[model samples]
Target chain A: MEEKLLSGAELVIRGLEHLKVSTIFGVPGGAILPAYDPLYDSPIRHILARHEQGSGHMAEGYAQATGELGVVIATSGPGATNLITSLNNALMDSTPLLAITGQVATEAIGNDAFQEAYTVGLTMAATKHNYLITDASEIPQVLLEAKHIATTGRPGPVLVDIPKDILNQKAKWIEPKLVDLPGYKPTLDANPKMIQQAVNLIKDSKKPLLYVGGGIIHSKANIELFDLAQKFNIPVVTTLMGRGAFPDGHELCLGMPGMHGNYTATTSIQNSDLLIAIGVRFDDRVTANPKFFAQNAKVIHADIDPAEIGKVRDAEVPIVGDAKSVIKGLIDKLGDTKLETSNWIQEINEMRESYPLTFTQDEDGPLKVPYVLEELQKMSEDDSIVVSGVGQHQMWISLHWKFTKPNTWLNSGGLGTMGYSLPAAIGAKAAYPDRQVLSLDGDGCFQMTCQELITASTENIPLKIVVFNNGNHGMVRQWQKIFYKNRFSASELTHHTPDYVKLAEAMGAVGLRMEQKSEVKDVFEKMLEINDKPVLVDCVVDPDDMVFPMVPAGGSNDVIILNEEDLKKI
Target chain B: MSERILSVLVEDKPGVLARISSTISRRGFNINSLSVGPTNIDGRSKMTIVTELESVEQVKKQLNKLINVIKIVELDPDNTIESEVLLMKVSINKDSQTSVIEKANLSGAKSVDVGQDYAVFELTGTSKELKKFENLMKPFGIIEMIRGGRIAIQSNL
Candidate 1:
């Protein structure tokens, strides 16, 4: 075959095309304009985001929803800097994301040229791997390597910064091939001896618990996890990142186990003799005080990243591999050695019965966030992709909704980034044009990136966003009420501001308002019925509503405040 | 916290140092000494980091996670062969010149330059020896000093 000569910009487009990238979530700017010219003529659809952060997050949402590589692009300087949060969020959550940024020309670099920034320096800590391409010929190899690094074991965000001159320069096109990475070998197979040790521990354990996290979803190990739980009669508890990794209604499942987790899940972790943590870092939120968390348990942690094994809580039997392989190894080694768990199940069942995830509200009172979430869950499809911004609404949806599939529930679990839902929902919609996507956002979080509604409107992405309007930073206010002697302080928002419906309309989307508690079912149905364009529902709720089943920061999991009745005890 | 030393081999690429340093600082470990230079192998570099960390378990694993980092070895503080080089400029006079030259000669410090009012000397020694020499010159009102951070090779290796 004859050699192909292409410009650096053409190489970038061809590289993404060869990588099977169908859609790009990006914002064009001064330095990146060269690539946009090639992109304008390519078959790949580009969704022009309003902000660089929005572009980054939309890419994350697409990746999380479809388990594919999400691509984002930005220009240098402020554009590159604006992508820091989204990149950080992707790194924290282990999303497979790629960011292509434009930098100043090679000769002009470090000259402090217009729209110039040290993009590689800015994103070094925020991404899994990053490169600043000075040579135009390196584009093909960098793209392949960046994609591999971003999507492989313990997936994360990788960035490639191409100078404007490099983009404009001509280069010989090379076939897609990965450069030699001597230090980048990721362990894909679990050690057989370690798996046998884990099996022996499970066989010896009287009360075992399967503690799962986002790695289960990332590696698609939910089936193996479910099989292990059912065969052994062990209970399962998920982390925030592990929301949909196991069936929410499964008999062995105990929902999330942490600060806002249910009583059954939190208390059970403390009581278990052997906690098999699969694909989870023992985050502080889950382990509050490591001294008191799972005190009786000898943990067997299995994860793809060796660094996560003993970072927070030490694991007696650490199996370093991808989640699917580790769980498969456990199942293969265990055979049919089922342990006795009738009494353990009965104990946890009683905990569930006594302290269920419930809430109280008067029939004619202000709308409640949980009530809206419950109605939304009821009306939505079983496979609907649900997303949330940070704060009370996120917690409420996590506590109340039932997610039965992996990758269906997306949120800023690690970074807890506000303004994540709108752009992320747009990305999710881009991935699944036919499936329903609902961005359930808090008022404070909604106001942060509501501007993305314009992108959704212009792109014709039929995304549905429901704003739980409590007229305050709901979680902050709740914390102040409980921990700060009821002082309002800087936590309050005016009862009426930009008028969300009017704002939605001005942004070219249909908006509806839900005030009466009685209108939740009808309003949710109405919201879901619209399919022509993006829709937003402003739900005014009682500001005092707060998430329960709480473990005060740094407190033991055993010491949970179950409800308002327990609040009086405090 | 007890001090720990980490020896890392990494790809000699642009910004690899920034990436490694940021990783160390983000972990909240206060680095006491750090040195980096090209290794015997082409396209590879070595770095030595000393910090007030009780254990290098997390730090070592985190460093290994970086794609460019080739290898890491935790050196024993007591056993490793480590040295630091120092260059010092000192103010001098007829009264102190003789004592300064005699002491520096005894300590094996080589004079880089000599002048009527000042003198420069280069010294290579272990950190303890360097610290003692620093204290020795402190009394003579040391004008300026540049101390290379500690670099080490494992004794067994």
Candidate 2:
């Protein structure tokens, strides 16, 4: 076959096509102009975000929605620097994200030329791996290797920074070779001895709780996890990142267990005799106080990343393998037997009934945020994808929303980056055009990335955005009210808040504002009916309505306050 | 606190050392001494690090998590041949040259060069022995000195 020459810019698009990337999210600039030129004729759909951060988060959203590699592109210097927060967010959450940034010419890399940034150095610590492609021939291999690294073995964000000169240089077209990374081998199967030990622990315990995490969704092991739970008859409690890992409506589902978790979930783990922690790193939020967390439980951790096995709390039986494989191993070892935990389940149900998630609203008062989420959840389809911005609204969505499917609930759990939902919802909508994609955001979070609404309208993505407008940073204000003598300080946003309804209308989307509780259902139904363009609902919620069942920072799970009266006692 | 010696084999790539050291420091582990150099194998290097063992397990896991690190083995100080090289330039006078040479000889050191005002001596020993030798050379008005960080190899026996 006669060899054909192609520019590095063309190779980039070809590389993405080879990876089956149908869409990308980014904004182009000077150093990245060459790459954008080729993109003009490419089949890949490019989402031009208002900010680099938005693009990075949109990539994350796309990855989370569909278990595939998400790609983001940006220019050098300030543009690449703007992606730091989202990159860190993806890294911390184990999301498979690939960010490609344009750099100055190879000759001007270290000379600090226009739009020049040391992207490799800046992203080294924040990414799973990073590369600086100075040669055009390295483009094919680098992109393929980056995809491999980003999607395999405890996935995380990877970065590739290509200089402008390299993008312009012509190179012979060659097929991408398989990555030969000897040092990058990840353990994918649990050892037989470790599996036997975990099985022994599971069999011996009268009370065993399956603590699941985002790794279930990342590895697409929810079916395996669900099967294991069913076969073993073990109660399951997911972390915030693992919201939809197991069916929330299932009998064994104890809901989320963390700082803002359900009382039953938190207390059940505290009282359980064995904790089968699957694909979860015992983060500070999950383990409010590590010393007291699961004090009565012996841990058997199964995760792909060995480093996370005992990073926070020691695991008695550590199985370093993929979640699906380990769960299958456990099932195989156990045979056709289920552990007996009738008394434990009865006790957990009692706790759940005793301290259920509840809120109150007056006949003629500001709409409660929880009520809005509950109504929204009821109105949405079963497979609807809900992406949330970080704040009290996120907590409310996690607490009140009924997530019946895995990978349906998306939020910034680890980094807790605000301004995540607007662009993320667009990405999710683009990925799954038929599915209902909604962005449940807070007013404070909405203001940060609301500019992306223009992209949503222009791209013809019909994303439903619901802003829980409490006129304040509700989480910070709640913390201040509880911990800082009620001094609001910089938490208030009422003084300079945008008119979201008008703003959404100006951005060429249907806007609806609901101030009264009676109007919420009607307005939400109307918003959901707008299928041609995006819809925004500015819901006026009570500013003082705080997330309850709160476990103060560094406080033990036993110290969780269920309501305002419990808060006073505490 | 327990003192641990960790020997690491890594790809000879730029920023590998920086990545390892920074990761160690970021995790709040104090690197007492670190030495890095090429191994006999091409495109590979060895690093010897001495650090406190308060969070040693976490530190080890973090180190192994780095992509450049090929292998890591914890060497027991009692079962390893630990050695460090020291070079010292001692100020010499008519009365002090003979005494300095005698002291250097007692410490199993050799005079590498002799000058009018000063003399340079080279020594190789365990870290503790080097510390003692440094103290001995300190009284002789040592003008310039540098000690190579500790490196170790497992003893056959």
List where candidate 2 sits over 4 angstroms from the true fold: B113-116
> What does the i-RMS of model 2 come to?
1.3
lDDT of 2 by residue, A1-570 (tens): 778888999999988888889999999998888999989999999999989998999999999899889999999999999998889999999999999999999999789898888888888778888888978888888899999999999999999999999999999767889856756788998899999999999999999999999989888889989999887789999999998899998999999888999889999999999999998999998899899999999999999998898888889999999999999899999998767888988988898888888988788977888887887788888999999999788988898898888879999999999998888888899899998999999988998989999999998999899988889999999999999999999999982358888999999898899988789889989988989999999888899998988999999998889888788766
Error of 1 at A262 (Å): 0.8
Q: Where is the poorest 10-residue window by lDDT in model 1 chain A?
A: A561-570
Interface RMSD of each: 0.7, 1.3
What's each prediction's TM-score? Answer: 0.97, 0.97
lDDT for model 1: 0.91
TM-score of decoy 1: 0.97
Fraction of the reference Cα-Cα interface contacts (below 8 Å) that each candidate reproduces: 0.80, 0.40
Error of 1 at A437 (Å): 0.7
Candidate whose lDDT is highest = 1
